[model samples]
Target: MAKDFSDGIKLSQPRPYLTRMMLFLALVGFLLLILAPRIMDAFLANPGLNGLIVGTLFIGMLYAFRQVLQLGPEVKWVNAFRRADPGLALPPAPQLLAPMATMLGNRKGRMTLSAGSMRAMLDSIGSRLDEQREISRYMIGLLIFLGLLGTFWGLLITVSSVGDTLQSLNVEATDSASVFTSLREGLQAPLRGMGTAFSSSLFGLTGSLILGFLDLQAGQAQNRFYNELEEWLSTVTNVIDVPATAGENTTPEQASLLALAGQIAALTEQLHAEQRLVRELAENQAAIRPALEELAGSLKKRGS
Candidate 1:
């Protein structure tokens, strides 16, 4: 039985960036399990600040993962289009690759493969990538900021308590036992203050380190996706598309797409015009051959 391409090629499964993310997270979890006792003690020492840092770190990780996930559709869109059969419907393209869906041209009510001058396309992709990464970058900065805030806050508490303890101490007391008892009670407050300082610092710094690594993973994924798109564009040649007419009921998105297609069509015309000019110049040179030969003959006879 022969299968018809009336239906477009089946799209390949989207590649995932979660594998490395999951593996790295698992490793962190294992390490945390081993240090559970120490971590529990620190959390107890300053529950308020430590809990905040941990919560923010979790949110940032989720955001980073989502950014990487969004990149998957773009790669999938490009790959499917590259392999798609002409006049057959393939899966829908992501927003970033929407230009390709139109730029390829819709012929006889079906898609046809066409690619040319990837610079504009690449630039568009890069700008979208920048927009997506912006939030993740801000989250990273926020994590670091929170860590620093906790450190200074804890230090302030320690400093204030130590100053109060010093002021309350008596140099000379009528009864030595009473003086020692009062001194011990005041010293306890300073010790607890020191605990708050060290515990908050520990959790804040650890949370930042973990989030930083996840951010690095996200960056590498984006770079790889961009490079793949660039390489695919290199091997393609141009096709001049006829921009579709927009109807009164057309949505803003569709209108924008039509405009982009029109721009590309204009550029293609310019390229073809330049090609025609070069061909004309070559033909003119060919036409002058006989005249050039006669001129040379006349000059030779005169010289002789």
Candidate 2:
């Protein structure tokens, strides 16, 4: 009459979770688009409102997309693992030790494989980093395009208004009242056009600046990670032959044990470093949380 513990909880697949999140975001974006006109109108009614709205939306969208990109590989890895063995009780995927072993045994292969793997790793990292940069660049370009579109629309309005003023002046025979009215209409068009041009340009520039800053920060973080990974790989690849056991030929068991021991030592070092980093991060969070909360409270009070 033992109860099965597995029935109460069902595990969700990574792919579905990712898809759901992406879909949810898309839906939200669509909703935002639908309300954009009203939102724009509201902003137009208030001073500095457009800046806040545009900045917040651009930053939020960039952050969300960046998060998706960051999580994408993890999701893929998880889905790969799930698809690899359906039983869910399968052993973890084996590491490709053959290449490492071949490299260790053959000096030439060792050099070749080491160099190749290092190059491949570097290239992969560089490609991903480049993709991030490209995305940021494209976003900047899009912003600029939108700004130009706004400028064109504004210019069109200005031109139409000027034409109407001219026609009215011609028809009204140079009366002072007609001139003033026509002039006012002409001014309205240019004024509206200028506002559109300036607002769009401001949003575009602000988006580019914010995204550029975020991209730089992300690049720095990624580079730091890459450096750490490279160091770890270098350490791993520097494995040397351990002295053979006394009075016996070097058996496979002994060699494997030595290699494993070396690997364990390396892993231990890495774990210690990671643990220290985590501890420092936790400590920093602990220290910063209070200050952050206080700042938030002060801002809230001011806003209220």
Candidate 3:
């Protein structure tokens, strides 16, 4: 059933900007992962940590690319729905929005599409829209955590080396030259450890920034698609009060509908006028009440 509808309805190509942005992010991420090791000697020494950071970045980038692909079908669905006839018809709807069309089909009474039904349709699509956002958020957090983890791991190495060197130094057995050599070797280890710490931090921060931007762009695109869909649905889909019957006298029914509509409109105007009069009376009540009370007292006194 899904295949049949998909074959019938034309799908638009992915937006160029989205495609280009994904490509740009992929290329840059690839370059960074490749060059980081050669450019920074520390990465070469700690290949495992650097690899993990780069790997995490690639995962985030791929997820963003997948989100862009999902949005393409949505764009096509919105465009088709916008161009479809306002009356009840098999409008071009995406798989995600197929429930809406189905809901309309199941209607049997004089009930038109109500605001509640519209809300339900939008809520159905909202889940799909939120999926990418949720994934992006997780990726962004994970990338940052990995970076921080690397930084702390490098710091731990530095601390451990310092402790080992201090424990190895002997005061009684080593001469001045020997002690000096021990100190020099100990200091060198810490410097190397510091380099690893800084290298991991640098890569981690860069990865997080890239993922953040991609996530932001994806969110914007999703929002735009949703707004367009909502506007189109609002304008094209209507709340049909009267249900059209098959092979029956529609003339009397239509005339009755028109009469009912006219009556409702007249009643609405009448209600508004009555409400205005009530408001005016309420506003003047404070001033008028005292005068009316005074007149009543005067009339009583005159009677007495």
Give the local distance difference test score of model 2.
0.55
Would you give me the overall lDDT of model 3?
0.72
lDDT of each: 0.73, 0.55, 0.72
**Candidate 2 structure quality by residue, lDDT tens digits, 95-173:** 2222322323323211222445655665765566566567666666666666566667667776877777666665546
Per-residue lDDT over 1-304 for candidate 3, one digit per residue giving the tens place of the 0 to 100 score: 0111112333345586486676877788689689865646856646788788879888987788777777786676555643444454644566666776667554433324455676788888888779758988887888778778877888988999899888988867648999988888888887777877887887788888888888877777777667765654554345555665643537877878878989999999999999999999998998799999999999999999
Q: In candidate 1, what are the lDDT values of residues 1-304, reduced to their tens digit?
A: 2222243433333244577788889999999999999889878877887788788889989888877787778767666665665666878778877875666546443332334336777787788878877877777777677767767777787788778877887868788888889888887776776677777777767777877787778877887777866655544534565565556657799889889999999999999999999999999999998999999999999999
TM-score top scorer: 1
RMSD (CA, Å), candidate 2 to true, equals 27.0
**Alpha-carbon runs more than 4 Å astray in model 2:** 1-60, 63-113, 171-175, 239-304
Worst 10 residues of 3 by lDDT: 1-10
TM-score of each: 0.66, 0.45, 0.62
Q: Candidate 3: which stretches are off by over 4 Å?
A: 1-16, 19-40, 81-95, 104-112, 171-176, 237-304
Whichever of 1 and 3 has more lDDT, that candidate is 1
Best by lDDT: 1
